[model samples]
Target: MEFDASHSSSSLGARVVLIPLEGKVIRYAFKLEFQNTNNTAEYEALLLGLVEVKKLHIKMLKVKGDAELIVKQVRGLFAIKNERLRHYRNHVWDKIEAFNSFSIEAVLREFNSKADSLVVYAALLVPHPDFTTNTYRVELVYRLSIPDNFESWQVLENDK
Candidate 1:
């Protein structure tokens, strides 16, 4: 699943999508953007997917993403220092706690290419060229490498 949140001509919008390798492309929600940071947008994507999973009564998820920061944050390694991100992190943690079982993992961008493509396509709908954007969480899946789980800060190996 993925999401791209931003504004188009002074409107608050968000898009929430989830893609399962085994099933259909689930579009949970979509909007232009709201008052949100990229970190918040990323958390929304994960939370939206979790919402669907809850509705479906499914448990035990191996959620994959390309964002090292988000993956690390979710894994309890990186601290959410920003006041803005703290809220999102807390929101995501709440959704995670609702689940029976789940694990967030970093994956190669190649594995998340389709969702990244969705972000680019979503960008085209906005009317304003200079609108504040928050596509980070979804598109960033293409930048992560194999992770090192050796230590507490080892959510990723060679993260740039």
Candidate 2:
């Protein structure tokens, strides 16, 4: 599926992207935070996208965004300078490399406004969950319990 997101940066306007990841669409959500710059937020979106997509166990992905600086940085065309962004950038790189293959492309603002709006809306949403890792809507509603001592050996012996 191709997921597009755009984040409003208040002082700097908004940033957005489209990401394609193969999966069951079991989960979907976004997070907004205080950051040093808009570029960082854009990269953070991609990083978060990859991390969450990985949790879905998908093998391929394509990331699209309107932030040219972020796409360039991720593609190695630009050097990351901010100390905080450096860590976030590295984290995103690690997530991207974990996949068998991934790509990032720069999109025009005209094409990414909706996603950019999502970013801003997410940032301002109230009554939001507090967890750092995103979750599926189904996962959030279901409750599962497992016994403390249900070992495989026990199951094998029970078969007899």
Candidate 3:
């Protein structure tokens, strides 16, 4: 798995790419409405990646990121000084404990390009008016109440 984050003046973007040993790839992107530093954004991406792994019932994982500080801290080689960083570290630990085995490594940004591109894509996403329809129409937006429950949302054509 690889993760990355990008920040703009108005928003923060985070993304993670998971590649299993079987060679399948999964990607996630998120846009944060709040302001955050680059390091904080990296932490958010890491946390989001871990959550996705847990949801997939992955027992072991090797995580790679370009953030040296986060990689070292997660590996217990560096100390977290900032209070906010400490909190993020604690959350990372909590999620890691659920895994049977977990390892993290810092890699050059060049090798982490997929995750980097995802972050850039997320950063560029902007909400705009839906011009496809000339008539204004009310559409029901449905969301699953339970997070990470993809199976619950599957619909058969007949049911729809």
Candidate 4:
């Protein structure tokens, strides 16, 4: 899964792209209807992707995001001092347990361009009626080589 978040004057949006082993690609872009911070929006995108992946009974998952702090927190490296973020982290952990294997890494924005583009579009566009149908459906919606137990900050090993 590749996730990204964007905020406009009045809305927060998230986008996720899921590519399964079967080679089918699914994409999701949704506007957050509630008040949220960028961190929360990032988590929302991840949570949404996890939910859909669980529904599909995917056994393994690789999560990629441009949010460094959130990725580190989920990896148990950073201390989550905020209660809200702690809660989000707990939720992420809960979802992660359903998978046989999981790995998450922080990625540069340019590498996550598709989801990033969807986030900007979601934040700014007035969607057509068909968009809602496209947004929530199960039919909708990369690899970073950072080691699972790495101790320090690691740069992305591959860009494409």
Give the candidate number with the greatest TM-score. 4
For residues 42-141, write the lDDT of model 1, one tens digit per residue.
6655665666677877666677766768778888899888755555565577677866777888777677654544544444443233223432222222
Poorest lDDT segment (10 consecutive residues) of candidate 1:
139-148
lDDT computed for candidate 3 = 0.74
For model 4, residues 127-156, the per-residue Cα lDDT tens digits are: 523355544331122111112333232233
Model 3: CA > 4 A from native: 126-160
lDDT of each: 0.54, 0.52, 0.74, 0.75
Candidate 4 similarity to native, TM-score: 0.78
In model 1, what lDDT does residue 85 have? 58
Model 1 TM = 0.61
Better of 3 and 4 by TM-score: 4
Residue 138 of model 1 has an lDDT of 24
Per residue, candidate 3 scores C-alpha lDDT tens digits across 19-135 of: 888955777777755657888789888987887788899999999999999999888899989866766776688789998989999999999998887676566564223212231
lDDT of 3 at 149: 30
Error of 1 at 24 (Å): 3.5
Show model 4 residue runs off by greater than 4 Å. Answer: 127-160
- Residue pairs in collision within model 2: 5-115, 6-115, 6-116, 6-119, 7-119, 27-136
Order of models, best lDDT first: 4, 3, 1, 2
Write model 2 residue lDDT over 13-68, tens digit each, in one string. Answer: 22222343333223243554343355555654565566567776877777667778
| Candidate 1 off by > 4 Å | 1-29, 126-160
lDDT of 2 at 67: 74
* Sliding window of 10 residues with minimal summed lDDT for model 2: 137-146
